[model samples]
Target: MSDDRRTTVPVWTLATADVKAPGLPAGESMTGERLAELRGVLAVMADEPIVTLEAHPLPDRIDRGRGIPLDAASPLAQHLSQFITQSARTSLTAARATASGECLYRMVVPAKVAAQLGQGTVRSMVSKAGAGGVLSPLVGPSGKIAAHASYVPVGRAAAVGTVGGAGATAGAAAAGGTALTVAAPLVLMAVAVGVSAYADQQRRQAIEHITELLEQLQEDKLDDERSALNGCRAAIDKATAILLDQGRLGVSLGLDSAVHTIDTALSKVEIRLGRWRSALDGIPEDAAVELATLTKAFPGIDDQGGAFRVHLELAALAVALKRRVVVLQAVEHAQSDPGNPFENFTRQLKRDQQWLDELELGVAAVLVRLSAVKLARPSGLRPVFTPSEVDRLMNAAHRIHQLGVGVTVDGRPTDVAIEIARDKDGSVTVFPALPA
Candidate 1:
């Protein structure tokens, strides 16, 4: 019966169905989408509003030799439909979980409410609660589940009416009197009941199909998010180890007051650099800029002369450096090309990881100073922490480093590192060779 007929599926944004079929008016077929969407209208008319949902193959529209349309519906759809009865609306469990770590409140009170709920419905109840952000912005790098499950509400109805008609005009019958009229009405009633039951089943099945679709979209979005999170954590780990090896964090945070104290010292250095620039401006030189750099990038750096390019190379090594620190080291390229030596193709993404080790200590120090995550330094402050005190400071570093030996510093692996001796006074030295 659906042969050569175009099947139209409406989109979500539209409240009214606009399905256009030629035999009917432009909006006439819309009734099929929502004769108050057929589900609602039927519920209202029938004393019992039973609906059964089932998943079945879509009727394929086969092409004849001519137009895209005008072909028979797919035989598969018809076959599947014939097999299914009113078994589509079976209930599923209410409990659900979202893998994405997205929260439950967001769904309970969705971020955006659509037109299906009228303006009055908003005023009716939900409007009293104010809106809020979906995900907690404070959620750290750790993974946690944050979603809640939900279910759909539905109504049920009863199946009534005789298998066939009971009454008929007996006087107008054939030679057998009541027989001819009696049989005709009975057949009509049989057809009506069967058609009614089938239509009800179809409506229920369609709703269930929609629900499954919504769940799938949510799962796919979660998968993409989880993958991105793993990438970030990997990047952090790689960069942090490189910085730790170069001692950037140590140089940066080795002196408690010294680290925070650098800001005022840095400002003074900048002022002196300006004075030197003015003095050099009048003198002509082959490389005034390089000469000037030698005089004043900063007192810690400039007066202690070194190359900027060298700084860049050291920066690469101190990948675990949570902040900038001065150091010198040689870099060997595994595969050398004409490309920049400071940048390795494999290690580009992990650059910022070095910064965490540096700032974390600084932050902890400030917090202990200001009372934050945790930190402890000597009450007695001088030029810097005494050497003995600094050695004891390593205790604050993870009791067990996350690197755990599989990590490398300058191609030296540390899957297993042993402590040869400890200066019982207060120092621990680990000698990790190429670990097996």
Candidate 2:
């Protein structure tokens, strides 16, 4: 360990009482907390913040110290002795305040756990720990380094006290503003700007790709007279793919990992769509049979009545799908335009992406329900969907409308709760349950 090599990070004190424990391995009362605290002390030695450490308790291992007895007769005395030995070992490596007004300390532990403690406290830890290139992994007691903890502190946090004399404050201030101190901040700022610009360019490229795909979807869907279903399906599939790709990009950009909700919804929609299409394939023949029975039971009602009912059900389903895809398309150009490249990061990108995801999920769910419909001719030759289904679709549409096509919320969108209501024309309306 060297004075100059130690990483500069925040420091905190820990009480021996706080370090006591029912240790990690179910019965190990000393090692679990003891190990973590030891790591924390090591981090402090590296001039990094000593906040807390996450304990990785090895399982099915002896909880007691090595070569220790398990006799219940003197268990307490044995445990106390072990604890004292551990404390002494820790103190040997802890930061020292010398008479010359200097602080010096060093310790070592498993590199993986050490890295976790170092994250955010010091940037160097994140890179070094994550890279695992400069240091070797420490093996614990589990016979392959998994159960044992071993580390050798290779860095020390050392600082000399400022001299106390007349005009000390002025001298210290002048010394603090050395070329290194002034140049370091400027260098860091420049690097930050460069990274921000690079991120902005990547974001712009991805968004541009999304917009191009949306445009293609729109152009394809223009001819809705005959190929509405095919066009809508094609568009929806493209949008889903775009979202999934963006999710991967987001993870690469450090927005989040594999647990993105948007990506999950897209996958679910694709699977459910296959099932929905299967359901839809049987609807026409089923509707014809149901209509024939209705005509037989009611002689006055002609086959035209059944035909109209089937047509309405199919139209409703098709329209719902189209709207869902279109809503996704609309968001493409609707989000907030990118701001200064040097200022914006993935946070803004994530927000815009999440808004689209929520809309996609809601609309996709509506399509799922519509696809599940049996579509048999209604008794009165009316649209087969219940009032609730109609209302649900309408509400889904409303949510999409509120979110819009933009990255920013343009319309002071209300987060309203709605109830099913019938209009004068007997059509369903999603009336707001909460008063204005």
Candidate 3:
């Protein structure tokens, strides 16, 4: 995550399809108009300023030949060309899918462009792109399209800041012919010094903020809470060591262990929450109706007495742990080498903080909903959460789940391709697709 090594960029997969031209049939090359139409469809789907696009043969179909580089005269075409080419080169799954007439059109939009165009506009464009059979027989009835977005890390040159500054300084100096030659080296050196100092200052500020957050978490009283907090601290320390080039190999070994500790803790809480939610869902219809009608506390009512209090505590703890993990990830990204020029680290950090805030609010709202339940003392009653309350709590839990603790469902990261097919009747069906 060192500042000199990786630069993260946002990428969007506008559309991917296994195209079959019913009109052209097998072995018939696509006509110019059809190709243009297909390209236009891809353009609309992307909806963002494209940097490049290229096509590659899917792995099984690589024997068919290399990818075709399309002409980039049009803006969308040019963007598509760059995006497709990058996808083919960078992702094995994407590369493999390119063959056999499967087109995986991906685009990497700079943060600036994403900010300008916005996600709402992009989504609207995608909807418009999919509404009609723009490519007709080439990709209409038989095509499968799926869209996704992800972030990618790219390397940045360590000298980028210095070079950029020096260039500006040189440009200003150029007006004085002889003076320019004499001032060039001094200007370059000055620029380099300024850039290094600024980077160092930014890095220091980020580290200080992360360290301060870690300190607050370390004050937790519970043993499990303390352990999770310690893991976060360790992970951040390891990341810092790696990024700062201090004991990198040794620190790297413990990094995963620290991350795993946090993951294991979060998983346990998730499981408990899931079981609690399931218990609520399993309440009998009669019991739910009775509970809803009860206006006052009744003895022996609420068979799952105290359960609400316990689950709420667990939910609060989960939120706290997740907040730490979020900060840990931000540290990793914010400290990466050379830094991502396209990314606004402060803005991203603020967004993560905001998400964590929303998650806390959601859990709090669930707690407020629980206040309506009238728990009765003693045993033997068949009372449970009211149907409406159950529904509300379930919805809140779902929102919390959607926010996620950054845990991958399968415990490891891997791509799963899905095929989304739209029928002639306008109905759509989606299912997982096996890699070729």
**Which number leads on TM-score?**
3
lDDT of each: 0.22, 0.27, 0.31
Report, for all candidates in order, the number of backbone clashes. Answer: 23, 20, 23
Name the better of 2 and 3 by lDDT: 3
**Backbone clash tally (model 1):** 23
Candidate 3, residues 147-212: lDDT per residue as tens digits? 111223121111111212111111111121111011112111111122222222222333444344
For candidate 3, give the lDDT of residue 28. 29
TM-score of 1: 0.14
lDDT of 1 at 129: 28
lDDT score, candidate 3? 0.31
**Candidate 3 residue spans exceeding 4 A from truth:** 1-232, 235-253, 282-322, 334-339, 342-365, 376-436
Q: Any runs in candidate 1 off by more than 4 Å, and if so which?
A: 1-98, 102-260, 284-436
- Per-residue error at 54 for model 2, in Å? 20
TM-score of each: 0.14, 0.18, 0.28
